[model samples]
Target: MHVRNKSLTPLCGSSRVARLLVPSAACTLALSLSVWSSGAAAQAQGPNPPPLAMGLIVKLKESQTPSVVRLRPSVRPSDAAPSQRARLYAAANRKRVGFLIQKPTAFGAHVIHSGQFSSVDEAEAEAARLRQDPDVAWVLVNRLEQPLAGRVNTVAVPQSGGVYDDHFWLKDRTARPGVARFATAWGRIGANRSVAPVVTAVLDSGVLPNDDFSGRLLPGYDFVSEAQYARDGNGLDSDPTDLGDYLTSGEKQSNSAFSGSSCQVGNSSWHGTMVTSMLAPPAGSGFFGPGILAPLPGAVVLPVRIGGVCGAAISDVIEGMLWAAGIDYQGSPPANPNPARVINFSYGGSGTCRTGSATDTLYRQTVTALESKGALLVAAAGNGDGSVGVVGPIMPANCDGVVAVTALRKDGTKSSYANLIDGSLSAGYLGIAVAAGEFVSGSPGVTENLHLISDTGASTAVARYIRPDVDGTSFATPQVAGAAALALAVNPGLTVPALRQLLRDSATSYTNTYTTYAGSAPLCSSVNRANCRCDTGTCGVGVLDADKLVELALDLATNSPQPDFSAPAVAATSFVPQRGNGSLAGGGGGGGGGGSLEGVSLLGLLAALALGLRQRFKSGRP
Candidate 1:
């Protein structure tokens, strides 16, 4: 799914590679990964059944040069650079294979080598030798780490001023105990890294170059290649502006050959701008707005354009995601000059990461790569109005190693449309939500406050605010993102994994079942359908408490890895969620586990829609 414009919002391996397995016999079958399907199965949505290993480390058993058997002496002590010791070993091995970065430091910081043995025999021999040697601590085959997307976007800065507002999610109480108390957290963070800024990436519809972002918005790239949806008349370009993705009835109907009912016609929502405002609103900039990070120094916003009027292609979104993280793809836009420390993807679809699936394997590799870089990826759990596990397993959100954030209302109850969490505890860590506004259908003026006013990146008009802003988990994700940014800004030493744990640990707990806007039946839940009205993964350990998160961040400023404390590690691929209505939920909200309409996916609705309107090439417009 692509980024939602205020709405809630690939790999190759074989003709279809789906899983990666290490040959248990070692070296006998070096780099073995293969799967196939005859005529039709190959054409479906599933990946071909083969697994590919990208990287592997093998040490020579003899003095074949400092003994490829060079042992780490021990697991390297905590006081010592265990990561460095491992790297030195890797560097030595790499040197024999012409590898670069010979010097290494820190433990668990093994270098990701791109070399794979040429044949089965060679790999097996090396694997056998390494196994027999009493040197190495651990040998892993999942080595090829896809680096950060590309060079990060950087921006120059000036000074500004503003007082924290009561409505600011970071400071004020949204009539809920789960709110982020950033104002309090700032006390510790502010004094430590007085000038350090945490770079944040806003992945969404193009953000216009506006004054609100003054000296903080960096030069981002436009990854949407489809000219029609981009409305720019050109494919992927250097410009990341909101080329205006307005749509009409005809576009959603005939011009696009879509279901008229599933699509909406309207002007672009300037989603990236809205999300950026919340993340790093310009401080002391008048009524334009006060942001979660804006009040602080050293926080930069990187605007990455990944969607258009018709949403974005999954390919483009991934590319943008990688680029923002400083990993360049195909090398076109060059490496990100200013890679962000935190990436906020406020949209998703009803897809899933099935166990033993090739797609899931590849997703894990990428997610792990980013985490290794100390970057935090925060995503919306989804706004499908159903259980996320039941309706989703959405990209990034559902993918392993990502922080999945659900949405909540000002009253600390589950938002009617928020998605519930279902991934396992460790890698499938899920985060609860904070104020993402609520819309009352029957009651008028029940105004839900999730306001973060700022300049419409594309407009010349002054700053403005949304009463009950187009509500969705899309909005809630940023609150977490902002809180995270604050933590990093104040304490730059936190690693992605540690930071994620701190956020999860510090969040306010939702002790009771959450009530939907209209008091819907049966709240949401992870294991039992009888317990929730619209559960978003066990209330996600509670709402995001900015103050508490900061406290945790301060305590963990040393960047130590936290012990895994999560539960329900999303079972390997077997997704069978129990829906409130008594149906065995599927990913994407289908009768079984299909696609989720949870947040902002464009899977065309099938209410027997007299045939109307559509994340694949990742889909939506509002």
Candidate 2:
């Protein structure tokens, strides 16, 4: 596999990279809060309006040709197709709709331009008319999707004095809910040198290979199809390096090209870098600490650039998803050598799963495709404000078979920024939740939201960009993905549904603490949407507990009944429903688990079982 920036050494080992940092300085400086633009906030209210008149992505029934006039990219001599006449529809009350038939996409959809419209409403009306055509299978407006996170308040200052621990969430805690007690889990992962490196794909803004990633990056493809959004001077390409996504003042003007575009004008969010580093930063790269998956022998991250300055188009996102799962679909880019076991979608927008709309059908189909490949899809529940009137988590998160994860504060109550299930049948989506904080203390009354994020648009420069007080479901999503990767590292054969069950089952219950930064909090429901406590039925299964998750995975590998050892394992379609107690559920199928126990004897299985039991009992869950 081709790794980006193969010459760059690991962050801790590279003196050259270290020179880019400032002397160990510390400051409690308060930076201005750069919140999401109103454009993004408007997206939470409904499905993003399709680009004014760029085109609509539509899939046709098998062997059916479009009746609308097909317009090719050019009318040059080399270009074959020209304008063709179509059947007239008086009900549409429009002349012939001219279409530019772009190349077929990886998801079997065709991008076509059906005449430019005056407004989004006009375009949507045209789309509705097209959906009624007999040849069309499904139609998508090709709306844009934004990263489901925002900078609440962050400053890239030096570490505070005294014994500093940047990664406080990983350590075991007795007072409140902590992520994972890495003692036994890390030790076992470190000792297993023969285990194959697990790949977790980050589908976000493009990534650049920095020292923090070191030896854990795989060759990725840029799926952004628009040159303006990509800002890379070209469309899709092999290089997924992030060019600056920052929009200028001129770009946001009413007469500018970005006027109707849903993208907000802001600084380039090195989103992919931040998420990748958090998921698998090198073991000792940052101040004597490791990321959730850094301790494993080989924890590889596949960076698939699907978003850009204007947010990712739905077509691009689906294409990136299919490619990341290593599925061989028509018109896809080169096959991915390293297929991801756990795919992290740290971005989302407004939309429910069962809306019965074309968007809903598209997401459901794509997610189902990923599951068939035995890859688990983990998505953020979105950072929609509580005032939006609970509609459950955002699209894709509410999609079936997906493990939707919401965010919580260090106090184990729902983070005010995260969107959650509101106990309404319309808003109910079964999944998991995790405390989004990196540091939380009771007596000192301090809750620092620290994350390994990029403070600069310059992808190569490391500097001192440990963004403190970063809050969003975006930050919380990757932790779950990394924990899922760690579980897969222990048992590579865990099926997608089974992995979801194990992770949900092993999660720690919410403390149900009503106290929060917003003062006395109430329980969140379909109506109570403010700063509130989370219940299993409302938020998710519970807060993520990596220690218990890995322990249970180990137990399942040793104790589960052996299936046929002849052919590869096929993942089951349905999974065990969410529950509180930690119990292994769902049958396993293909997921690179072939021959995992082919040569091992019964005695070895028994020994492994004993080890898992010992770690579980002695790990001190309380």
Instruction: Look at candidate 1 and tell me the lDDT of residue 575.
Output: 18
Clashing pairs in 2: 422-526, 569-589, 569-590, 570-590
Model 2 TM-score relative to the real fold: 0.73
lDDT (Cα, tens digit) per residue for candidate 2, span 1-622? 0001100001110011011110000001111123211111111222322323335665543332211121111101111112111222221234334464364553344565532212344546667777777655555666553333333334444433211264556666444453455544677666655444688998877776655677768888898776765778788899888774555546556434466444344455566766776776667664424677776655488889876654566777878887887754435676677778789987665567676776667677677657655578888776553222244677777887777777666666776556775445333245777666422223111354644555543322344454544555666778788888888877776766678778867877665333323436677776665457788667877778787888787787777632211112122111111111211111111111112232222333343344334334433333
- Candidate 1, residues 486-591, lDDT tens digits: the string is 7776566565656767787887655542332344445565443222343334555677887778777766655443221111121111111111121101111211
Each model's TM-score?
0.58, 0.73
Off by over 4 Å in 1: 1-168, 191-195, 250-265, 355-358, 385-393, 423-428, 441-446, 452-468, 512-523, 526-537, 558-622
Q: Where is model 2 more than 4 Å wrong at Cα? A: 1-54, 64-101, 113-122, 146-148, 157-164, 182-184, 188-194, 252-256, 386-389, 422-429, 438-446, 458-468, 511-520, 561-622
How far out, in Å, is residue 316 in model 1?
0.5
lDDT of candidate 1 vs native?
0.45
